[model samples]
Target chain A: MIGAAQLLPFSLLGALVGADVVSFPQAMLSRPIVAATLGGALAGNVAAGVLTGAVLEMVAMETLPVGASRYPEWGSASLVGGAIAGWHPVMRPGAINHGVFVGIATAWAGGWSMYALRRLNGVWAERALPAMEAGSRRAVMSLQLRGLTADLFRAAIVTAIALLVWTPINDYALAHWTVGRAAAHSILAAAAAAVAGGAIWRQSHGAAGSKWYLLAGAVLGVVLVIVA
Target chain B: MTASDRAPTTIAPALSWSARIAVFTRMFAVQGSWNYETMLGPGIGFCAEPALRELPGGPDGPAYRDALARETRYFNAHPYLAAVAIGALVRAELEGRPAGQIERFRTAMCGPLGSLGDRLVWAGWLPFCSLVALLAFGLHASPLVIVLLFLGLYNAGHVALRAWGVSTGWRSGLRVAASLGSPLLQRGPQYLARAVLFLAGLALPLAIARVIGRRGLEIPSHDWKIALPLAALFAIVLAALLVRLPARVEGWRAALVVLAVLILISIAR
Candidate 1:
C-alpha cells in the first residue's frame, strides 16, 4: 500500500542523478546499478533491485551519451528498477521480471519528462530576456532556478505515483503470473543475448575490414556457454 | 542599424561560471529525445527561427535589442536548443558581428554539428556504454554494482563530452570525431576496446560458473526455440522492406521501424 508520499525519495534521487548527468560535481551515484540498488535499499529490497539493476546496466553498457545524442532515460530506468525491486514481493523468486517491465517503462517515461522539462526551461529563459539584456543577473538566476525546481518536482511526482500504484499490482502479478523456469530462462537469456549480439553487430558492422569483431563476440558467446 | 552598434559597443552580458554550468546541464535536457534539428523545429538548433515579439519601447530605442529579445525568446522556448544557439551567439557577439552575420554562422554549424552529434554522441557513444552494462547482466552481478558501473562509464563519458563541447567550439568537437575517422572506421577502435573490457567483464561470471557448473545456474532443457528465429526472420523481412522503401521516409520512421522490430522480438516469448 505504498502511497505518493512514499515515492519522494526515489523522485529526489532520480532528479539528483539526472542532474549529475549534466551538472553538479558529477558523482557517478546516479548510475543504474547504484541508483536502483539505493532505491531497493530504501524500500527494503536492496538485493532484488541491485541484482536487476546490475543486469540492466550491463545490457545498457553500449549506450554512450555523447554530444546532443539522445540516450535511454536511465534516470527513470534505474529508478524503476529500484522501485520494482524494493516493492515487489520476494517470497517468490520471479521478482526480476517485474523489475524489468517497470524499469523499461520508467525509462520511457523519464525520456518524455526530460523533453518537457527542456521545453519549460526554454520558455522560462525567454520570459526573462528583457531583464537579462538589462544586466539583471537576478532575473537570469531566477529563471534558471525555475527550470531546476520544476525538474526536481517532476521527478518526485513520477516516483511517488509509480511506487504507490505499481507495488500492489506487482504483488498480484507475482501471485498469479506463471511460467515454467525453462521458458522464463530461455526467453530472458535469449532476449539478453540478442541485445548483446546487436551491440556487437553495431560495432562490428561499422568497421572497415573488421568482420572479426562479430566473430569475436560470437566466440565470446560460445565461450560463455562452454564455461558456464 | 547604427554604426556604433556595429562598432562592437553592444557587449553581450558575461555569463558567470555558475551560468556556464547551468548551460552545461542544459545538454542533458536534449540527450535522449531528439537531435538538434528536431528540437529547434527545423532550422539551426535554435537560432534559425527565433520567435519575434513587440517591445513596449519607442521606434529607435535599440531595435537590435528587440532582436535580442527575439533571440531570448528562442532560448526560452527551449533551453537545450538555446544553449547551442547561445554558443554561437556568444561567438558572434565576441566577434562584433550583426544578427545577420550571427545567423549565417549558426546555420553553417547546425547541420554538421547535428549530424555528427547524432552519430558520435547519441548513436555511437551511448550504445557502447550499454554494451558494458550488458556484460554485467551476463555476469548476474548485484544490481548495485551494475548501476555504479553504468554510472561510471556513461556519465563520465557524457559529462566529459559536454565539457569538451563547451570548452572547445563545435569545430573541436568535430575534430575529436574526425580523429576517430569516418563512422565506419571509428568503431574499430571501440571494438578493440570492447574486446579488452569483455575479458574484464567476463572474469567473475566465468569463475562463478565454474564453481556452480551443472548446478544452481543451469538453464532448464527445452525444445529448440522457435521464437527468436522467428523474430530474426521478421526483422530481416522488415529490414528488407525498409531498405526497399524510398529514402524520403523520415529518420524517425526508420527508428520506429527498428524499435518495432525489437519490441516484437522481445515480447514474442
Candidate 2:
C-alpha cells in the first residue's frame, strides 16, 4: 500500500504533467526526460530516473502527436516509471526494464483515458450546445473548465492507480528476474535503436533535400562519437 | 440613423491592446475543450469570449451574443496557429464584416492553419529540438541542463510564434492569407525539417552508442570488444535506415511487440 503522503504529491505531479500533454501550457515539461526526472526526484533517485527516461525517450521518438491522433501519453506514465525505477536506485538491469514496462502500460492506459475524456467532453458539448448557441459565457466557461479539470483528475487517477497496481508487480518481477545485466540491457538497446532507425527512415524517405542533410549529419555524428 | 450605423474608423479605439492581450493569453488554452463534435470550436469561443464581451455593445449587447454564438460554432486548427485564426476572426468581427463572409474566412483558414502548424511545430521543430536534447544526453550533459535547454529553446520559438501569429493575424485581418505567404510560414517548415533530419542523423548514432555504453552491457577489456559493438550497432542502424516500414506500422509499435515477447521470455525463465 502506498503511503498517503507519497500518494498525494505523486498524484498531483501526474495531474500537472498529464495536463501539460494537451491541456494548459504545453510547455513540454511532460517530456519523458523532464517528467521522469521529476518523478525520480520525488522518489529519491534522480540518476535512475534519468537513465530510464533516456530509454523511454528513444521509444517515444516514434510518436508524432499530430491532429489529435491517439498517441501514447508519456508524461504521467513516465513519471510512474521513473518513480518505480527511482525507488530501487540500483544500476541493475531488471529495475530499469521493469520500470519501463510499467510506464508503457500506464501510458497505454493514459491514452485511453484521454480518449474517454474527449468523449465526455463531446457529451458535455452536446449538452451545452443550446446555451452556447445563445452565447452564454457561463456555458462556455463551464464546459472549458470542466474539461480541463477532468483531464487533470484523469491523469492523477491513472498515475495513482498504475503505481498501486504495478509497484508489487515490479517488485516481484525484480525479485524473480534471472537475466544477466548485459543480456537484458543489450536487447533493450537494440530495440530502442531499431525504433530510432525506423523513425529516421520515415522522416527522410519521401522528403526533398532532407536526405542529404541526414547523410551529412550521419558523418558528423560518427566524428563526434569517435572524438567524444 | 444611429451613431452605431457609422463603421468604426480605426480598430484601436474599438478594441484596446488590453483586449488583444486577453485574447492572446486565452489562446494558450485553445485546446482545453477539444471534443469530437466541435474539435476546438468551444475552445476558440472560450478564447474569444473576452474580446466578444468587449464588442461595441458590450457584454449584454446583441452583437456580443451574436459574435460569441458564431464563434462557438464548429472550428478547428492547430492549437498554436489558432491564435492567428482568432486574431483574424476578431478583426473581422470588429470591422462589422458580414456573417457569411466571416464564416467563410474561418472555414478557409482552418485547413491552412492546421497544415502549417503541423509541419512547422509537430513534424519539424519538435523533432529537431528533441534530437538536440538527446544529443546532449549522449554527450553526457547534466539532466537539468538537458531539460532546461529543451524547454527553453522550444518554448521561446513557440511562444514567439504564437505572439507573432496573433499580431500578424490582427494586422492583416481578412487578408491574412497574404500574411501566410510570408517566408517564415512557407519556408520555415522546410528549413526546420532539414534541421531535424540533420540532427536525427547526428544524434541517433550517439544514442545507440549511449545505449551500448550503459552499465548493463558488459564487454571484456579487449580493444576489439569495444570496437566490435559500435560497428555492429552502426550496421544495424544502417540496415534500419534502408528498410522501409509498411504503412500503419511504427518503430515503437513494433518494438513494443518485441519487448512484450522478451518480457514474457524473461518472466517465463
Maximum-TM-score candidate: 2
Poorly placed runs, candidate 1 (over 4 Å): A3-6, A18-34, A54-74, A86-91, A109-140, A195-204, B1-92, B140-145, B170-269
In model 1, what lDDT does residue B129 have? 59
**True interface contacts reproduced, per candidate:** 0.08, 0.58
**What's the C-alpha lDDT at position A17 in model 2?**
93
Query: What local lDDT does model 1 show for residue A162?
Result: 63
Candidate 1, position B19, lDDT? 43
Q: Which of the numbered candidates is closest to the native, going by highest DockQ?
A: 2
Per-prediction TM-score to the true structure, in the order listed: 0.64, 0.93
Candidate 2 to truth, TM: 0.93
| Share of reference contacts kept by candidate 1 | 0.08
Q: What's the alpha carbon RMSD for model 2?
A: 2.6
